[model samples]
Target: MTLLRDLPLSALRALAAAARTGGLTRAAEELGVTPGAVGHQLRQLEDRLGVKLVRREGNGIVLTRIAEAALPDIDRGFDALASGLRRLRFERRADTFTIAADPSFSSLWLAPRLGNVRAALGKLDVRIVVSIALDSMLEEGIDLAISYRYSSARDLASADLFTERVIPACAPTLIRNRSDRDGVEMLDRLPLLHIDQTMGDDVYPTWANWFTAAGRKRKNIDHGPRFPLTVLAAQAAVSGMGALLASELVLRQHLDSGQLVEIARDVPALTIKRRLVWPVDGPKARRASAVAMALAAVARAEADGLRSAVS
Candidate 1:
């Protein structure tokens, strides 16, 4: 007879992640553990069971028959254990919250307001996962999400967060040299910086879009050095590498501080809307509501502050 009490949760989790992700390296990345550690745990589990769970292939791993046979039951057991743990922890801690959001917004906006949340709750932990992929809240164990999307979530309770508004921006020195230049003229003189495609569909208002919106054309829309993210692209523009189209929300502080200056401020703005989403039922809903309230308060405060500063 085998004892279920002898199984380690970490070893079981490693197996499931490896099975789901198709590799140990990917599982390690998602679990925030070393690949060696996950591999070790997998090997330990196989040793305890006296079975070969996986085998090394050419630069990859293949699951053995035993692993396949054992995993479905292991996954079910993990799910049940997770549900019980969540309920117990929720009942005990009662106030800590976790959220999932876009990386840029989480870093640039929400992080600054955590002090406010901490003050309100007395003690709270807000875990934020920043990825472009829209995660399943229940599956991923996230309480709330801030995502850019065209339609509101009817399946989940949701609220409007904010729209993205983009404008051409560059170092103040570049702006000072040609303060009177329009969008087309500025593009002629400056290296038109392009954002690398890593941000997926969310990164828009490209130079092409901006030029089209302005009823002008620029041949270098697809040209110039590409950066991996807005943070890097914006940094390049701030250093006078070239002109950049950045969200007014993200660049407001820079604009206010004179680090980056907008070109053709009168041109029509380009915008994309975003929203807050959460499950409609369960304890997650209460946690989601609390987070939403905090987010709304913070966003409103930021908007008001920026509006006043701009005025």
Candidate 2:
């Protein structure tokens, strides 16, 4: 950019605000300066540019034809400059917290609870990056992360938000025909829904694990349609596709909305832990601490209500 340090930034700001507000007093209110100061800046700007910029009109002031022609560009330039400065300020400080999480968790759980977090944090800005690729948390400058698997990074701080019990879930209509008490036994007979995303990771406990936990011996545990995401798998199960082993905490909304129901509430629930992770050694780690506190508040507020809903 060409150096225009000779043009006073304060004068340009006053001119743009006056143009936008259509009056000196309103511009002064926005700029936190007096109308006389604004008028003086406008005069100085006009003198520097060697042009008449404003004229007295009745009891008010109006932009001259030359100033009117320049108003649009000046407004655009000053607005862009202010915006760039705001971004830089956010970047330098800890006002904005960047978060990363699994899409399913982000959509089903964390996104819904962000309102509470926002309320707790008050003035903090949150940027959410949803992806299954969470190993890059440190590289991405993620202040906080919600992940299905536990973190093994020695340099990162981790907190267990909550553990979810996995249960057989399906559309209520799917099991409505079988009113018998041993409906969970039918889970083996139906086409079991398997989330294919966890096939490669092997960290998330799968259908086989759930069956073992439920004390059933099914050899064909891998026989089900595959989906790339858990959210998709849960939706498919809700559509009466097949029974899916889903998280009790994650499936609360589906259970509450009657989209899906657990096959056996008393049976042993498969347990899975969700965690919050962030680098231990970052300048913005303090903000991460604040976020963690907010998350804890959210968890405390929801834990009893969620667990009691079906316990």
Candidate 3:
């Protein structure tokens, strides 16, 4: 309860340590200082306060009633100060931002474009967690949630990123090297890599959907090496494991590189729009807005590229 505004932080730290450890020697060892230095600090503090903070006891220092009562508050102040310093260091290091997205979008879409975003927003740390269930942006610590949905919940804000269109694609080798093979015939030689979402009991775009859209149904749509994510299925196709139903967003690079070639032009799958959702308030909302702007720019460019390709 004494005024000690002009006291040095080091002296305050030393007093806090001696009080906690019950002796100057132990406190000095813990603080990597000599016992005499700690003792000097305690004496200086007592002189400043005009009180006897420590009393001589058998082989140890005993705190006076005033020191005992005040030490806990002093300790708490120092702890709070240390915590604030740590937080300041983290904030100075970089602003942290986290996005919640589906695995397919993360691996196939956002992951590829993250470098551009990083370049645009320097000294910003970004993380992505994949899950199908919609997360409350405030509750789950998400800055943004990208989902294939019509609208965000009433409590959340939203932006429509872009729509998804798919095409049947296979390794270029399959078509270039096996020119004699037809769609049905090629199935026997090359695997029909099916994305096995049955385990999770989720409805996902399948080879059957593509075939049916083309007015041709392959009875063996369910056959081949199965993967949980569409991105994995696309990779399998890239590796020549089999053909996959590739979303336009996921396979843009492969199609451009001639790594994956469209098997049929007639089968255009149903389009699905990706929406960005975020909470109305907090640090996360600000981060989400910045990220959404960058992402929207990317989506626009992609759409333009697709338009050129289609034209």
Q: Can you give the TM-score per candidate against the true fold?
A: 0.66, 0.62, 0.57
Instruction: List the candidate numbers ranked by TM-score, top first.
Output: 1, 2, 3
lDDT of 2 by residue, 1-311 (tens): 24385668999888878877878998999999999999999999887789998877766678889988988888888788878987776575466677877667777778787887775555777778764345676665677877766767787787888777877888887775544324567775777888765411356778877777677788677988888777888889888898887677667789899898888555677777777777787877766777777886688768788679979
lDDT for each candidate structure: 0.74, 0.76, 0.72
Q: Ranking under lDDT, best-scoring first?
A: 2, 1, 3
Worst 10 residues of 1 by lDDT: 196-205
Worst 10 residues of 3 by lDDT: 176-185
Q: Which candidate is the best by lDDT?
A: 2
Clash pairs, candidate 1, are none
lDDT of 1 by residue, 59-141 (tens): 66778987889888988998898889988866654555677765666778878877866644435666777644443566555
What residue pairs clash in candidate 2, if any at all?
A: 166-270
Instruction: Predict model 1's lDDT versus the native.
Output: 0.74
Clashes of each: 0, 1, 0
TM-score of model 3 relative to the true fold? 0.57
